[model samples]
Target: MDVRISKRRTTGQMSVFELDALREAFRRSVRENNVTEVQWAEHAERFVKSMIRKESRGIQA
Candidate 1:
């Protein structure tokens, strides 16, 4: 699977540590499922959005 991180406008920038964590999460997802590329992308997008929302709300994600 090709895992690419696109540069886009977000509520805030993620630190290197956060990005690494996200990458690991994606890898775990891949390991647990046989998802298509599109599905993987969607999953990643949702995860990122949730993270941003949680941060904005001052909650742990």
Candidate 2:
């Protein structure tokens, strides 16, 4: 967590129509699940712990 990493996704010169389609796809996924705020935090914590365990074992998450 101490290390900082910054990355950007740059798709070279796409049309507005193409951009709209991509944006819509992302929005759809974000709304696909209906998790409450508390549930989300719980899931997130569990995911982080799982990731740490996986890394300790040198396995892909």
Candidate 3:
């Protein structure tokens, strides 16, 4: 299966509250389920489709 992975980096001083919120969400997700070992090839396919759909909707709006 064809696959694509996109990565990005942002450089800035993030607020403490924003950082804490992100950390909390990650902790919650990990506590809820073990997502570390799943096969992600299919997930990537769905992710790309979802992003495209969202972008098209934003454009239409």
Which predicted model would earn the best lDDT? 1
Per-residue lDDT tens digits for candidate 2, residues 1-61, read 1122111113235467856875575445446655466566665566557645764585332
Candidate 1 lDDT trough over 10 residues, lowest sum = 1-10
Q: Which ten contiguous residues of candidate 2 have the minimum total lDDT?
A: 1-10
Off by over 4 Å in 2: 1-34, 59-61
Question: Between 2 and 3, whose lDDT is larger?
Answer: 3
lDDT of 3: 0.52
The per-candidate count of clashes, in order, stands at 0, 0, 0
lDDT of 1 by residue, 5-60 (tens): 22323334556887898789778876777667769778778767976687658533
Error of 3 at 21 (Å): 17
**Top-TM-score structure, candidate number:** 1
Task: Write the residue-wise lDDT of candidate 3 on 1-61 in tens digits.
Answer: 1121111112334467856865675555555654453634554455457655875696466
Determine the backbone clash count of candidate 2: 0
Of the two candidates 1 and 2, the one with more favorable lDDT, higher being better, is 1
State the displacement of the C-alpha of residue 12, model 3, in Å, after optimal TM-score superposition. 27
lDDT at 60 for candidate 1?
Answer: 30
Q: What is the TM-score of each predicted model, taking all chains together?
A: 0.48, 0.36, 0.40
Global lDDT scores for all candidate models: 0.67, 0.51, 0.52
